[model samples]
Target: MINLDGALYPWRFRLVIAVLLGMVGVIAWRIVDLHVFDHDFLKAHGDARSVRHIPIPAHRGLITDRNGEPLAVSTPVITLWGNPKELMRQRQQWPALAAALGQDAEVLSRRLQQNAGREFLYLARGLTPEQGDAVLAHKIPGVYSLEEFRRFYPAGEVTAHMVGFTDIDDQGREGVELAFEQWLAGVPGQREVLKDRRGRLIKDVGVARNAKPGRELALSIDLRLQYLAHRELRNALVENKAKAGSLVILDVQTGEVLAMVNHPTYNPNNKRNLQPQAMRNRALIDVFEPGSTVKPISMLAALQSGRWQPTDTVEVYPHSLRIGRFTIRDVSRGGGPVLDLAGILIRSSNVGISKIAFDIGGESIYRVMQQVGLGQDTGLGFPGEQVGNLPNHRKWPQAETATLSYGYGLSVTAMQLVHAYATIANNGRMVPLSLARVDQPANSTQVVPEEVAKTVQGMLQQVVEAPGGAHRAQVPGYHVAGKSGTARKTSAGSKGYQQNAYRSLFAGFGPASAPRLAAVVVIDEPGGEGYYGGLVSAPVFSKVMAGALRLMNIAPDNLPPPLPEQQQAGALPGNGGRG
Candidate 1:
């Protein structure tokens, strides 16, 4: 009986061993199916359901003045981001996370629920360091901060037009920023990371892309001059009770813009309260009739073409002359039949200038105007610059020609007129106006002959020093040459001047022996006392020019002679004769 039972037991043990071997084979086959045979399928599933890292923006470039003073810059900021997949996984901790971040738990829950399994989403942007650090310190799964940059204007309203401001994402919106966005903005960088089951960053295994920063811009503007111009213009705006004002200072030789300022300017820093009109750059964007400031250019054209001499006298039809349907009048009703070109300019005689323009022919005068950069952009690269209107021969009505001769009927920008005046100040050499510091080509074109420029400068100085000339422009210690402009602003859509609305302008350069700074100042509708360019704008020009000369250490040319009051009254008025 024992022998038979033992044989049965041995057979049963052998059967058990065979069954275990079969089960092992099946397990190995299943492992091979999942790990190797279905590798592609598993990889696709993992790719579709994984934590992905997005890119963060790089720092922007610096905007500095010629002296390396920072005009515009950027500071690091933070933005909150979320991984909906992880946020949903840790739904139990939502209350604590939302409380610390000032987010409603129920709202966050709905947001996460709605975006279930989403890889990435934005929470908030432009957060402060402390605020961002508090949220990041919570260590909530899927919630993180992205480092970024926000634009900062160091000089505030002082450099608003030059440095410009950027949008929230660091894109340029205006000024130099808008003009050179591509060069100033940089590419963003990215990284891919593997997270643990808890959504904690494990290790960075691969780089998605490289980051590039913006290129720095170095402008030709001098910060000192910019501040000076801004201060003066602001004071003028307040003192004169003006609608607006603009001032520009240029280097006569290089035509580089030392300073360009517009009053009623808004600060680029806190733009929350800015108005549309306050941010406008009036110098380049606005146009006005230039009046007698244009007289010098007309006279220059006459001398250039041998049409008239600075000394040549023209009979100025008494007080007024009718040109076609319009009557041309002078500032003063002179009891004179004849007046020299010098006398005409000195007296700011509208009728005398009309005769000169008639003799030179409108075509020649218009050609000279074009050559001198009138009725066009000066190529300064400023944004929103308007190319002002210049009526052609076919468009010029009978009254147009005469009115244009005295700086009406045609429109010009302050910068264009200043640039044209600078060409004469630079002794006929017309260099393009530059706001950025790039070397010009070796060969520069000449706009007028040297003698022609000299002749014009001489005539302009006489206009300031002449008797019965518009006064208040005399500087104590320099020989200044320029023209005064007092013209009425034309009504919109109408061909007539606006009553009591005048543009007062003074354009000049000193010390006259060798011009350094060619400056222009314009006041819109200055009231009280007098509004003529000689009375209103010239005093400002003298004050600024004197300061500029002192700052640059430019030696005085002819220190103004002592006043007759200071000394014995010798020469009677108008007896100084022609300069």
Candidate 2:
């Protein structure tokens, strides 16, 4: 401490070291904070400049037949969308964009001006991938292409009535498309994507939310049978020069609608200039008085009432049945004075059916009809299905009851008629009708006595077997039991019957010994050589059934009997009449 100007104190040395070390420590701490503590925050800010959330398209569910044949498919497509605000700033590119989209430049300008306030607007929808790629190649600002799917029907017009069609935006419009819209429309998702300064996608970062594809729907239809039905129905329509027609085939065991088709149908893919009425699924929605087709059900009622036996004979006055102010007449003549129930149905005598109906009372017949699904909705929930009309039988007078017995007062869709027949074919047990493939048979209800049903079914077999009574409906190698009806259509206002307006119908099942399939065919306004159900509709039924039974490998129940007296024994087994 003696020479203060020349000597340094220990405190001063310690202070100098402290200042240097503190400076280094502060620098090291700042480096650690920047590299570790604040790393995530700074990185997020850096990404915000180029990161984006993009949409991931969800495809619609596939529609297939029971055999996994694709009926409706979702095809990959691209949609062009844009941010109007951003697009408006690049007005110079409008002409190029319009030319790419095949639109007028002037029109595009007006549309853009009207939509400048909107953040998003669609330029084109359902464009081909090539078209979208071409548009994107131009690299127009604010214009973006989004991947999407369009519903395409492979079966086209053949399965149009069942599959239906969708709108341009992929929204369901009619048929199964509309009925199961909720189940078929999937949820779209989002994903994080990296983009360049020019708004071009660079990389997929990660899925923000995974897309959920729609569940696949397998319908109960068999495409093979559908084609068969369509071909046969179309032939009938063209051959008979009929206005329209419908045909339905149902599996008796499972109550499955194997095939259903309608005429004057529109292609699902091409709906331009499509008539609204052409889209109607006539088989399910169109209602007609079943005509003579219900005659068997009437006999079923009579048997159930214990008032008449199928073998019991009724005194007949041909074309001579008068009920109150109305006179019920049969179109046939030259019959025996006394006719049994079998003969009555064979000739389709309105008088005989009416007498049986009146004796048993309309209430009895109504009970049977009601149990057989008349005026009831099939649980299939098909779009545009009509419940049809079934008035209270107790309110019917004698004339009304008689007409009801012969299938006039009540109405039935082709689907309902087939259901009733299928029930009887299933041994009087009613099962739920299904349009979807079912793993198990639905619960059955005894709508009519099994014995009554069997007896009536046998009587129908005899009628079909009888000469000149739906003989045309016989399927080669199969024993068919069915009824034919030629009814004069009522006037539009229900005022009275119209002339030259007939609905020819045939409804029956094959392999009568052991029923497996039931079908119904209705030909409207047949303007050909013959218009009777047996002539017009029966031939179509026979062709379709023959092909269907053979296709299904159903065993031949009616092997042609050896010719009586060996007359024309040379005739083919399937072509020769019953011996």
Candidate 3:
């Protein structure tokens, strides 16, 4: 205080204060630049590093039976993916990563090399949440997981051919899955997510679009009936040692397919069992000569021609008829008995039916077959459905007409055959087949006069009920109406029919008086000593029909009146004859 002014220079004090103020000004300007001018640029760069737009996987549609039972569905799963560029840098950790993923280290290395240029690579798909979490627990950098969906088939091989299957990407690849892929697929959404520098997800910021799930599909098949058909058909196929087979059950009233199954099926859930031969939907895809199953239709045609009546007569006692260079023979050896029109169908007389076809003219038979929907698509919209070969002969030859009477020289699918039988069951009206559930009664068209259809039903009932009939086709509590057809398959690399290989078939409906269901069973190349339709295919029809009649609550038209003396003596009715 005595000499303060003399102790310091004025310019030096001013310079100290000025220097401190300049530093503060410089810092304030820097804050302004960072907060205002460069704020958006820095924020964008930071977002590029830590904020990521991730896809939200959508779920596929469901497939259900007529009763809303889930046949096919999708479950949420985790898909492991990685940035090859970033993952390759952590080569030392590859063994651990592969171990966690249950993949070989060498394989992982090759995969990385294969996708070196790819920014993202799929490590695994359709992994269960547990599996994904176990791998994620390792916290391997650049390895991330995204949500996905995997298809699960609950009915397995029982409904495999009909419900079909999907691929790893949830893409429908077979059967109904392929038929309705568009309707079964969903739309994926996007969301912004925050991640750490190691690429681990931190938090979801906001959703851009919510995922839209696929729509559900309902099929016409009842799971209960489908199960019954599958069990019976599978058992029969295994017992017969057949190469392949198909069985189709139709709701005669509604024309809806209740159950359609194939042999040598594959479980859709298991990818290892996939084979073209096993996955084929034989009922709709494969065709064969219908054999004597067409006898009812031939009689229908004969009666419709007005040239013949149910009371007409033909001499089939001789068991053989010479027509041109071909000879038509019956299995009946005991001769000299004339049969009426109904008797011809009951015994499945080739000679008698051929006479009717020849007298009525072959064109008439062909025309009636056309009206019955033979050689045509069944309108099921099934993938790979075959339009069978029904040659329209402008002029009918005697030999061809004889073969036609016995169900040869033409090919038909099981679906088409059942569709015809359903027409008769539905009172001569051809029912429109449906694979999906329907809300209304089938829109049917009268393919024949209702009276003719009823008459044929009565005659077909005789084929199962009468003595020397297809007695194996008779059910315990129902008046089964059907026919057994045994036809020799054509020899491979040759023209004539094979002696051993046969296509055994049975087709008809149950509760003959007021039929509720129509079905067809075809056993291709059955093994062992039993190859006749009555012995092989008719039994399947009986068991399946019996169950279906009970399940549908249809009143039995004929309950047996206790065991007969022959049945009690272990001599089943008509158990020894050819179909």
Tens digit of per-residue lDDT, candidate 1, span 1-579: 356754768887788888999999899988898798878777767754564666868888888887789888888888898989878878788898788778888887888888887878877777788989988888887898888998888888987876678888889988889887888898898877776666667677687888889999887777888888888777776777788888888888787777788877888878889898887888888988898888888887888888687778988766788866667888776537788877777777888878778777777678788888899778766788888987778554546667777898788888898898888998888888887765562244588878988988887888777776645666778888778889898888976768898889999888788998889999999876778888788877877777777777889998656676624444665555684
Residue-wise C-alpha lDDT for candidate 3, range 1-579, written one tens digit per residue: 376653467887788889999999999988898789978877899999999988888898899999999999999899999999888798899999999999999999999989987879999988999999999999887898888999999999999999999998889888999888889899999999998986777988999889998899999999999999999998998999998889999989898899999998998998784788998999989888999999888888988988888887997767889976778898754324788988888878898899888898888888888889999877778889999988778788899998987899999999999999998887799888999898898667898999898999999998898888889988887887998999889877888888788999999898888888999999999996799999999999999999989998888767656787777666665676575
Q: Going through the candidates in order, what is the number of backbone clashes in each?
A: 0, 0, 0
Candidate lDDT scores, in order, read 0.81, 0.87, 0.89
> For each candidate, what TM-score against the reference?
0.83, 0.86, 0.86
TM-score between candidate 2 and the true structure: 0.86
**lDDT of prediction 1:** 0.81
Error of 1 at 342 (Å): 2.3
After superposition, the stretches of candidate 3 with alpha carbons farther than 4 Å from their true spots are 1-53, 193-203, 333-336, 492-494, 560-579
Cα lDDT for residue 182, candidate 3? 88
RMSD in Å for candidate 3, one decimal?
10.1
Model 2, range 395-451, lDDT digits (tens) per residue? 768977888899997888999999999988888999899888888988889998999
Using lDDT as the measure, the top candidate is: 3
| TM-score, structure 1 vs. true | 0.83
